[model samples]
Target: MTQEKLFASFLLDQTQGVEIALRAEQVTEATHIQGGIQKLPGSVDFLEGVMHLRDDVIPVINLKKRLGFTPDSYTQEAKVAVVSHFNTRYGLLFEDIKEVFRVKPEKILPINPALRTDDQAISALIKVEPGKRAVELLDLDHLFAGSNIDYTNEEPPHESTAKQRTYSRYVVFSSGGQEYGVSVEIAREITFCREINEIFRTGIVAGAIELRGRTIPIIDTQALFTNSETTELITDEHSRILILSAKNCSVGMIVDHIKEITTVADDSILPFPYSDNDNVKGMLSRLDGENTILLDVHNLLCNHVEAIKSMANIGNHKEQEHEDSDTGAHTVTHHLITENCYLIFSIGKNFAIEIKDVNEIIENDHVMRVPGASGCSTEVINLRGEVVPIINLRNFYQFDTKKKSETNKLIICSAHGQTVALEVDKIVTIYKQEQFYATPSLGNQLRSKKDTLDRLIEFLNDQEINEHVLVLNIHSLIRNHLQLETTSRQAADLHADQHADDTITEQAKG
Candidate 1:
């Protein structure tokens, strides 16, 4: 049974000539700001940068930037709208959150033909609230790539038949003029770019992450952002890494500059798009000033790590060389765990992998709801980038939609040559090596056993390691929950306004 949860419901501005639906937690009431634009430095991705709420550094994003429209001014006179994801939280610097209203699912109508802007982007537009004005019903998920900062707040996850996410503490960074956040949990280490162990044919964005002795997967942040935008990288010599975990997943995010860490509430943020970008989870709460984005950890890892694992076959030759070295030839196979160990997460009856794999158990720190996510997702969380993907377990597994519960968490593990993140109802216990294994027979069945990885082997874990626990195939798992474009069909005349729906979504490649 696939479970579905209404993460949060929010209203967009009608004065903007569009009806937008915000994840319940996406909207927040601001206490200050009026007249006089505040020009803060950040990225095109966000409207501005980190701010302070009473004394805390609250991230503030601009709605104009998100809508692919230019604002007349970013003055302090603007209304501050606070948003939050399930685990992670953030705030939006809006013209007026008070303008936000509610619209019944049936009342939402796509933009008229006159509104058609792009032929490829924009799926559907809804009229929010029964008012004279209208706000664009935004597809926030497809719009914002998950934020970096973790939302789980470092709480342990629970064990259930569905997918779940925990929260954590994290840090945000600045690249070019944009502010990006990441969970301190998944971050492994920080350093400047001297020379990435570039491995050709290793996908579009990838290099190598150095662990104790092994060079794990290192995400190519430059490539990722470049693909997203046609902008250039403006960085300094001192680069930093927000390393969360290192297992079968990538080691860390190579950022331009490191920022300070902050705490947030998980109750207020919400999703943007009804369902779109798997990378972005939602936004955080507004604490007086500035709003930030909550990243989707799984989305980041999925794209970055996939470049290393899916696109490239680094270990094929490396392993063969290692075998030959045993025949008296000279060769150096780095690290103990050759392949990163990945953890298998099941939510809403769907499966996914933590970006990083782990050998030991770590606490998720805090557990809370993700704000600013879409109906497609249950919550937002902070893991890698301090913001990882927390699948709506209910949406995928049992069709259950229970909100705000104590038996949930963000589980971190090592495997699959990188770190993997997963949201869960609860976690059992970690198992030691030589006691678990992955078996091919275990496809997508739930291992009824809890407390140890061994029992999970019956279903969740494979017997590949015999007695050791085996991780599930994430590609298959993510595919289960995520809606894939099977044929790349261009949505014809999407704008209900007139021309098109403003063609907002730029896509990963665009």
Candidate 2:
């Protein structure tokens, strides 16, 4: 049988309005060009630059320029398509990604030899349904041939070393025209400063923003650093909120804009000469020959931590009293808040699952891809002696699968005696619900038979920001979303059978 082939389609030039497609298997991942590409000296014109993606630096090729076309400026919509060529990887810069589509072998029409040029890259044209536009299929091998770019021996040396010095990644941002950085470990995410509810008039606390039902205090970076009695709140398109979290506390610092996410070696950071300023940890030298003030997150947030915690306790007490007083009436509203700790993580959105449901959290490393895996279970990894299928929540949730960051974490969770790893963008924090606010009783409206989310709970974090977190029903997610075997024993048996079949096939070939 002639099987169907999948292709990822994208655009190189929006002006030309031509779609180009690449074999889906060749495309590993696509991501926005964050921070900007670092220019290398004496590089080719088509060789845009090397990008610091996750841990390893990969060379980014401007596909437009390579195709003998004028390259467009890198906009917010610009994306890099990371394509794997044998053991090496190269990122193809694109204007925007369109979609991933499948077509039968018959739909691919070969290009005429008369029309083909010696340096042509498009090997064939993909036929779409009646009125739709045709897509040009790219022959990556041919396109990259004669480029004189070495693809072999490009593996990062740190991967083979056991005692390689570790570097801390930082999210660098600007506040008051000065660049500052915070460890990516504590940096949750960067978001636009919008619709902040100015309920708090406390020093440096501008207000709070309600994010996914959670209220997080927004600290005015300018006011806090300048020691101003009042916060000068300014709203603009460029203003961004850098969300930082440690332990149970979460706060957002208003920054002018996010510069880049860069890695800095621990030993390379120069100590701040003045000891009186507890907020400044050290100075990190940037590639542009400027120093970025690395802020000590703990010390910077120390003053407001207690106040935020106290407010949460007070809110919880008041809420409990109100609930107790209204108990006499038959009310359908349910406000259930437990002291159980839950681990919060982000896929495309923030979700919280009971911490007890999680076995362990580990960095995503050395994941073995599984062919024809069911549902979102496209990969598997060996955890101790057990084979755990890795489930991409983003895929299951129909979110765009971007290039995996170094900070991406795999949550090993077991339910119904079946173990699986849930891949998440990053860990937000471990949250313990201290209080809960009553939400409108959705009854059965919010839930369906296959709903993975259980219920929503609104509470205050240590910063007293109202947080609404959707509690994930891990049991439902595992049982309903994951279409794998029911039990771990069944999964193990399946793996064994596949292994045996592979071994037998190898012996037969010999």
Candidate 3:
């Protein structure tokens, strides 16, 4: 009962003091550690195997490479502990678990005077305060004593209990702070900040949300777990706006608002500690903290569900990803960007902008050069007569295309007003996608998770060659350059206002 003596008559000091003695059926959930393991369980690098639990699969030991540089080994920083006993619950890969106590038999003590037990593996000695700093208690069975294998007992299987369930869809959200869910037919509504023209500078859908009148893609789900949030832009009000739907476009998700959706029954299920992400398939047990969580809705169409039906026929206009504070309306847009540099070239190898927003480099006659295109789509300039969509930065990056001095230009852009022409080879001056921050998507177990811009559109079974930096689509290069000058300026202003109202009705019938 020593979970600090059974939560010491209650309130366990709101866990700020910490406590986890488990037994109310082992108190099943908790997540944070995030990594561990360097090579063990049938190695070959299934991501260095071991260090996952929520369906259990643990075995951690890096307490920061055994307290910083332990005889040299485990690296990726290390920090895993994940313990479970008799019924086995592996994972002791620590590099950082710092604290978690519930002691109380008078702060438990014992071996004093001499200290330093040869091989070292403390497990217990705690104290708390009387002199300050004395936490030793970490002998999760002698540091996993030996780590036996045979993960036999198998769990995480329940198909559909609670009387074979039927009906119950919840999708309330709120990240970094808490509140979450997964289905409700994966929530396809909740929009509000209309007029979002499009800003998907790179993917994970961070640019469309114009509500009722259409236009989707807004996904920022905490910027895919760690991009913090900035380029995925959407400002605030905590910026809600969900949207969802993926078998063919339906993405608007500028989240941070949504909050309710209930109806549990599958006997209030279990299994979902990151469920290894097969798109996080399923799991929604919470009949009041019953634990369980991996319900993700295929990372909300960023998994390339055919690029969400070609970005749902290109942002069915109404515009929302074009912020300015909603001026007098009309999909307003403006761009002359050039950061750290990346309008480079090649969809296969060369890509790394940070060169600093780049806004200067033009060699027109309206560009007009498209005898051959496709290394990643480029070369089709016309600038003034308008058609600009050139991107041959060294044959789209396959590199090796010389001769073109006079400062070799052509990089003009205007975004929503359309005007793409990125055929670089030289002209290397600026660099700054802010200054180097986004760089995640490592061992992701996919399951509904696209929100690039504050980075998060992972998917890479192999696209190496110095990878990670492929963001071209300032809204399909400006929807093929301003859908024909926005349809000939609204048909030449409705044919000059119907020829000036038929010459004032022929001067009032003469």
Best prediction by TM-score = 2
On the 0 to 100 scale, the lDDT of residue 489 in model 3 is 60
Tell me the TM-score of model 3: 0.25
Every model's TM-score: 0.30, 0.42, 0.25
Which of the predicted structures, 2 or 3, would earn the higher TM-score when compared with the native? 2
Writing each residue's lDDT as its tens digit, candidate 3 over 354-443 gives: 212233345533444456433434357654466656655455324466765544455555455545666554432112233344445533
- Per-residue error for 123 in candidate 2, Å, reads 22
The collision pairs in model 2 are: 213-467, 213-468, 214-466, 214-467, 214-468, 215-465, 215-466, 215-467
Best by lDDT: 2
lDDT of 1 by residue, 248-363 (tens): 65555567655434444444556666577766656654443445566666665664443344312333324333435457776755433324323333343323232233222233
Q: lDDT by residue for model 2 over 405-433, one digit each (tens)? A: 87688887777878889899987655566
Point out where model 2 deviates above 4 Å.
1-57, 63-71, 75-164, 274-277, 310-510
